[model samples]
Target: MSERTYHHGDLRRAVLTAALDVIRTDGPSALSLRDLARRAGVSHAAPAHHFKDRSGLLTAIATEGYDLLAATLADAPDLRERGVHYVRFAVGHPAHFQVMFQPDLYRPDDPELLAAKARATEELRAGVADRTPAEDAGLMGIAAWSIAHGFATLLLSHNLDRPVGDRDAEEVFRALTGVTFRTQPAGSRVGDDTMQE
Candidate 1:
């Protein structure tokens, strides 16, 4: 459809969807507003009216990602489940996840981006608040984020070893963090504090 035919916000959403598709297949460096406009069947100048520049477009993507992540985190029942949701969000939205973490790709100082980031951060920290001692909550939060983010990154990059096989990401994360470390290889044994009689 032509730019004028997009009705209010539809052009923006269409361009954003096109950008996501490009990032998914070719990475963010491949994004071109002109190409996005062409994909959306709009004027060459159409994307610019909404995003202004490449950085602005990326900022919009990151803002949407953080808002989505915050909502996903809010749905979890507890901190551990929140961690699962975080990994799920990252794996599910690899393009947005990549741009969200790489500040150089977007306008970090954008007000709307900052607000969306704050919401996601608040949801993440809220999960850690009552679960740990006040003195250690900060570290605990970082640790929890580290695990989820690291796992998601590895999984996305195909860096996770064969031992993990084709297991579901959420299940692997749960096994890695909970009382059992079932994600480990077959020969591995969980340490035993009560094995000896």
Candidate 2:
């Protein structure tokens, strides 16, 4: 094997990027810091500087994923749009999505991971700021998160085999949301804006 060298000043970022690439193509089971170092053209021990071990590296990936998801969700116009954005991000960044939510595999409490997760949560909250009341914000957040997360998980697992047409998954998601929430318009008199409330 050719020994490639990464002279890039940002070794940590390089290692993380390489790790993400591996996760994308091979799934989380195949990830390793040594392997990432190799892919990044750095010495086997180089990754250790940034990520003390495999778990650390995975945590970094999860943290980055949260940040990315937060950015995507923040751009949506409303809560429903945020849900669509959530699904899109999950589908587009399967590797990151896989690592982000698997608390068993990564250290969710890591400072970076926690911060990123908080940012994403805040973004989701912002999306529903106008429509959902302060008292119902938490419930609204959970409901929206559940819908988007459930749908994305289903799609990722191939549980939903419906052949979506030329329309993007976001379009299909909106349609699904419409069908699911048709009765409740933006100003509907709902109980705490929650399904169980």
Q: What tens digits encode model 2's per-residue C-alpha lDDT throughout 91-156?
A: 998889988888988887788889999999899889767898889988887888899999898888
What is the number of backbone collisions in each predicted candidate, taken in the order shown? 0, 0
lDDT of each: 0.87, 0.83
Q: lDDT per residue, candidate 1, 21-67, as tens digits?
A: 99988999999999998898888888998899999999999999999
What is the Å distance of residue 2 in model 2 from its true position?
15
After superposition on all C-alphas, the RMSD of every candidate to the true structure, in Å, is 5.9, 6.2
Per-model TM-score versus the true fold? 0.87, 0.83
For candidate 1, the lDDT comes to 0.87
In model 2, which runs have C-alpha deviations exceeding 4 angstroms? Answer: 1-6, 163-166, 184-197
- Quote the RMSD, in angstroms, for model 1: 5.9
lDDT of 2 at 64: 85
> Where does candidate 1 clash, by residue pair?
none
